[model samples]
Target: MDNNGPAYHEMMELHEILNFKTLCLVKSKMMSGLVFDQDLKALMEKDVKQTTAAIQDLQSVYKPNGGIVH
Candidate 1:
């Protein structure tokens, strides 16, 4: 980390990005239930799993400790 870490604007931007991703994850999960195609449902399941893991990683980055994985 540098002497100057992420600025307020950067943090705010990260927050917004995570918010959007979370929304997308939820919507995709909901749509997965409504979709009838087997392949599409599997894809949606994969998407949900990957997005959830990614979100956890991003949250670690947003943590005060600067991305300590646990």
Candidate 2:
């Protein structure tokens, strides 16, 4: 069987791979702690807030389609 075809096992494997990568990133960041000083932390927080607001704005446009399932 060609690996690129839309097979159920292949899809499940791809999902598992993506989830493992996400877990690795989260674990690595948690282990490192904050690598920034107070000023940098404030700047990062501001950026995060702005990015979050932007995402919410986009979501608002599509939210009526259906709330996020997860």
Candidate 3:
């Protein structure tokens, strides 16, 4: 049995969440093209923005002193 990696368990979890957020953003953008209603399209765009901010927050967990990841 071997359990060794660069990131800690909690950090790995955050990384995974960040990946999910990114995927969701991409999927939302992709599906936006199929959204016929103007309201729904706007909602999806808002979600994309929120998801982007969420990813940034999640990445900050890995940064020192809550700084930006990049």
Give the TM-score comparing model 3 with the true structure, all chains together: 0.72
The TM-score values for the models, in the order shown, are: 0.81, 0.41, 0.72
Candidate 1 runs further than 4 Å off:
1-4, 64-70
Residues 1-70 of candidate 3: C-alpha lDDT, one tens digit per residue: 3434334556666667777888999999999999999999999999989998887777665653333344
Between which residue pairs do clashes occur in model 1? Answer: none
lDDT (Cα) of model 3:
0.76
For model 3, the superposed segments whose C-alpha errors exceed 4 Å read: 1-7, 63-70
lDDT tens digits by residue: candidate 1, 10-53: 77777788898899899999999999999999999999999999
Ranking by TM-score: 1, 3, 2
- Top-scoring candidate (TM-score): 1
Clashing pairs in 3: none
Each prediction's Cα RMSD? 3.4, 9.3, 6.2
Error of 1 at 16 (Å): 0.8
lDDT of 2 by residue, 6-65 (tens): 456545655555455455545544544564576666665565565556545444433232
What lDDT, from 0 to 1, does candidate 1 have?
Answer: 0.81
Clash count list over all predictions = 0, 0, 0
Q: Name the runs in model 2 displaced over 4 angstroms.
A: 1-5, 34-70
